[model samples]
Target: MAHDTGSSLTRIFAPAKPPAGAKAGTVGEAADAKPPVVVSLSASAPAAPAPAGAPAAKSFAEVTTDARAALDANLARMKESGRTLGMGANQGSQADIDAAFQGMDRRSLHAIASNSGGLFSKDEQAFAQTVMSQQLVEATGMDDPAGFQRDPARGFLAGVRFLDTVSAEEKASDNWRLNRAVAQTNYESSMTRDHPGEKAENVDSGDPVVNFLAQTIRSKEGTWTSVHDGSYVDDLSRITLFKDGTDASGLQKARQGAGTATRDAAARIDITL
Candidate 1:
C-alpha cells in the first residue's frame, strides 16, 4: 500500500495558569496552567461503501491470524535491522517475557511498552512494548480510575517516552510510533466514557480518539522542529498530549496511510486452513 506523507494534524497546548497558593513554575503548577487546543488534522475520509459482491468482513479468528502474521513479519524485519528481542531492563528473565506474551491478545501486546516503565534494553523490545501497551490499555482502562485521576500525568509521560524512544527507522517504516499514539488516543477515548463529570471538558476533543492521535503526531513533529530550529531545547521531561484543551496540527492525516495499510493487510489474510 502507498504511504501518505502529507496527512498530519497540528495541535497546540497553551500553558495553564498556576493554581492559587502554588509556587510559580512548579511542575504541577505549570502542567495545570496549560490549556489544550485541538485543531482538525484533516477531515476523515468517508468510509467507502462495500463494493458489490465484496467479501464479508473477516472472522475474528482470521483477523487475529492476519495480525499475528504482520507482527511476525515486522519482528523479523526488526531483527534484520540489528534490533534485539530480549528481556527489558527491569524484566527478570526470558521467562518473564515469554509469560507476558502467553495468552496475550495483539492489543495487549501493543500496550505493553507504554505500561512497562521504560525499562526496555533494546529498540525491538521497545517496539514490542508499544504494540503490547496499545493493546493492553485499550482492553483494560488506563489503570484504576482513582489511580489515573491521582496522577494522570504519569500515563501521559510514559506515552511520550515510548514515542521519543522509537527509532527513526521504525517510525518511518513500521509506523509503530503513529500506531502507538492512535492506540493511546483510543484508550483515552474509552476512559472518558468510563468516568463522567471529571475534567471532561479538559479532555474534550471533537472526537477524542482522532484528536488524541492528531495531538500525538503534532507533539512529535514539534519536538523534531524544536530540536533542529535552535529556538528551544528539546526536552521530554514534561511531555503532555492534553492541556487546557487538545488541538491537532495535521499529523494524523499523514499517518493514516500506515493505519490503513495495517488493516488492509489483515483483511487480506487467507484463512482457508
Candidate 2:
C-alpha cells in the first residue's frame, strides 16, 4: 500500500513549495493545504525639488547690509529728533575737539547746527564758532587771536593780556559787543584756578604771602627766559611764558609801545635817561 505523505505532520515539517517541474502531488498537497502569506515592503518617496528662480536663503553680505541699513535709519531718526550729534559735549581737550571735527564738511556742519531748528543760544554759537575756528586753524595754519586767550596751556596771564588788548581794540570797533561777549565767555571758561601747593615751587612755603611771592618770581623768571635771549628778545618765539604773567608777544608789544613813547618824549624834550 502507498504511504499517505500529505498527512498533517508532513504539512508542518516539509518545504512550502515543491521543486520546479517535480510531481506536484507530493508538495502541492502541502502547499495547497496552507499557502505562504505575502508581505509587500515599499520604500519611502523622495522629497520634491524646490521651484526654479525662487529666492534663496540670504548670504552673509545680504544680512550685514540689512543690519547696516537699520542702524543708519535709527541714526537718521535720532538726528531728526533735535539732538546734537557732534558738538563736543564730552570732549575736554583741543585734540579731542579736533578729532570730533575730522571728516566734517560744510553740509555736515550746517546739519549739526540746524538740528535744533536753527536756533542756538549765545554759548552754543560761541562753542560752534570755536569748533569752526579750530578747523580753520588746522587747515590754513592761521591762528585765531581770540583762541589763544581761550587756550588753557597759555595760562592766566596770557588770557588777561588778550582780554586787555581786545578790550582796547573793541572800543574803536563797531562790533565791540559781539567781540567782547565771545572774548569774555572764552576767558571765563579757560581760566585756571590756583590751589595751595599745586605747583612744585609752592610746596615748601609755610606762609601764603611767601608762597605767592615765590610763585610770582618763578612765573616771571620762566616768562623772561622764554622771551629773552642774550642780546634781545626773540620776536618769533611762540612759547607761552606765563599763565598769569606777560607772554613773549605781550612783552614785545609793550616794548614797542614804550619805544614809541620814549621817542616821542625825546623829540619834544631831548632828554636822555
Candidate 3:
C-alpha cells in the first residue's frame, strides 16, 4: 500500500468538519462536541466624550474654596499696595472691596457668612455681611436690608451679644424669611436687650426696625400729638408694635406692613416689587 503523507498529515493537523446536519463552530460527528471557545484579551471600550461647549460643573465645596482663595488673593493684593479694609490710616475704598466681591456668587457668600473660622477679620466679616444682606434684598425683594446690621466691631453673628441664637441649620438656610427673622431678632436684642445701661433713644443699635420706628415717630411728632406727648417716650418705643409677635391680631397687619416695605424697597431698586 502506498502511503499518502501529505493528505494524512493534513487530516491529522486540521480538525474534521462536522457532518451535514451539525451546528456551526462544532467539530466531528459526536452530538456532545463543543465549539472551541475564543476569548479576547483586548482593552476596554473608550468612554463617550462630553457634549460640545459645555464645561464641567463644580461642587459646593469647590466653589467655596475658589471663593475663599479669590478673597485671600484680593486681600493680599490690597496689602501689597499698602491698603486695608475698614477704618484705618490706609483703608481700602469700598469700590476695592466691592470689586473683589464680584468673584463670589450668592452660594459662595452664604458659605463665607456661615464660616466661624478666624480666616476673616472684623472688617472683612462686616463687608461680607453687608454684601450678603444687600444681595438678599436684591434677590428676594424683602424689606429691612438694614436689619442685617454689622458692627465691624464684633461682626454680624446670629444671636444676642456673645450667644449664638441661630441653629446650624438656620445659619445654613437659603430661605430669606429665616435670614431676615434672625437678623431682625439679633438687631432688636442688640438694641434693647443687649444694652441695658443706655437709654433706647440714645443707643445707635444699627437696627432697621428701631431706626425706622424712631425716625417715623420723630418725623410724625410734629404732626401727631401721640408721639409729641411723650406717651411712648421716644420713637424707639414704637418697637412695641412688634412686641405682639405673631398674634392673630398682629399677624395680618405685620404682613401688610412687610409687604408694603418690600415693595417700596424693590421699587427703589427698579425690580419686581
Candidate 4:
C-alpha cells in the first residue's frame, strides 16, 4: 500500500499518449498546426539623432521665454546700477545698455522698445533703437527704412544736431540773440502745434517734446516757423542742451528783456542829445 501511492498519483496526473502511427512531432490530430508568431508590447524606439553641426531649433514659446529671461536680467542689472525705468531726461552712455540688448530678436526688441506697455525706460528704448539701426544697416546696407521712421533715437539725434547747428550759427552772428529767439520760437510753435497738450516736464509722455522737435526738423519747414504762440523753448533747452535742469535760458522772457534793454538804451541816448 505504501509503495503504490506514488504510482497511483502519477497514473492519474500523466498526459494521455498519442494513438499508434502518429507523426514524431505531432500529437493525435495536431499534425497540421503551425508555430505561433511572437509580438512585442514594448515602447516605440527613440527619435533619430540630429545631424552633426546643426543648431537645435527652438519653438516660438521657447524663444520668447529665453528673450524675456534675458530682458529680466538686463533690467535687473540696470536697476541695480541706479537707472530709472521710464525717464528720457536722464543722460548717460548707451554702450552698456546696447550690450545688454545684444542677441535679442528684432520683434521682441521692437515690441519692448516701442514701450507700448510703458515698461521700458527711455534709455532702454534708445538702446534698442541703436541695436535695431545697426541690424538694419548690416542687413540692408541702409538704416533709413520707413518702418523705423518714428524711432526715438532718431528723434533725439535730430534734436541734438539741430541744437549743434543753431549754436554754431548763433556763435558767429552779431544778432545772435534775435536769431536764437527766432529759432527757439520756431521749435516751440511746431511742438505746441504737433503735441498740443503734452508738457515738456512730463518726460514719461514718450518724449513728446523730442518727437515734436524731430517731426518739425524733418518737415518741409525744417525747424522754421512763422507762427509764434508765445510758447518758450525752456524745457526743450534743458532736456536737450543741459541734459537735466530748470535753466530758464530758453524762455521767451529773455526776448522781452532784450527788447526792454534796447528801448532803455534808446531813451538814454535821446536824453543825452
What TM-score would every model get versus the actual structure? 0.24, 0.18, 0.33, 0.26
The digit string of per-residue lDDT tens for model 1 on 56-147 reads 86544454454455545544664687643443332222222332344444333333322223332343344344323322222222323344
The model with the greatest lDDT is: 3
lDDT over C-alpha atoms for residue 100 of model 2 = 33
Q: What are the root-mean-square deviations of the candidates from the true structure over C-alphas?
A: 19.6, 44.5, 35.6, 39.5
- Global lDDT of each model? 0.34, 0.30, 0.37, 0.35
Q: Which segments of model 1 are wrong by more than 4 Å?
A: 1-131, 134-141, 173-175, 179-273
Ranking by lDDT: 3, 4, 1, 2
TM-score of candidate 1 to 2 decimals = 0.24
At residue 165, candidate 4 shows an lDDT of 32
Error of 3 at 221 (Å): 22
- Evaluated against the true structure, the overall lDDT of model 1 is 0.34
What ranges in model 2 sit over 4 Å off? 1-91, 114-127, 138-140, 144-273
Model 3 spans with C-alpha error above 4 angstroms: 1-57, 87-92, 116-118, 139-171, 179-273
Q: How close is candidate 2 to the true structure, as a TM-score?
A: 0.18
Q: What are the per-residue Cα lDDT tens digits for candidate 2 across 76-159?
A: 654576533333342223332233334433223322322223344333333333442222222211133244224432332232
By summed lDDT, the worst window of 10 consecutive residues in model 4 runs over 34-43
lDDT of candidate 4 over 6-77, digit per residue (tens): 121112111122112211111111223221111111012222456999897655445445656777787678
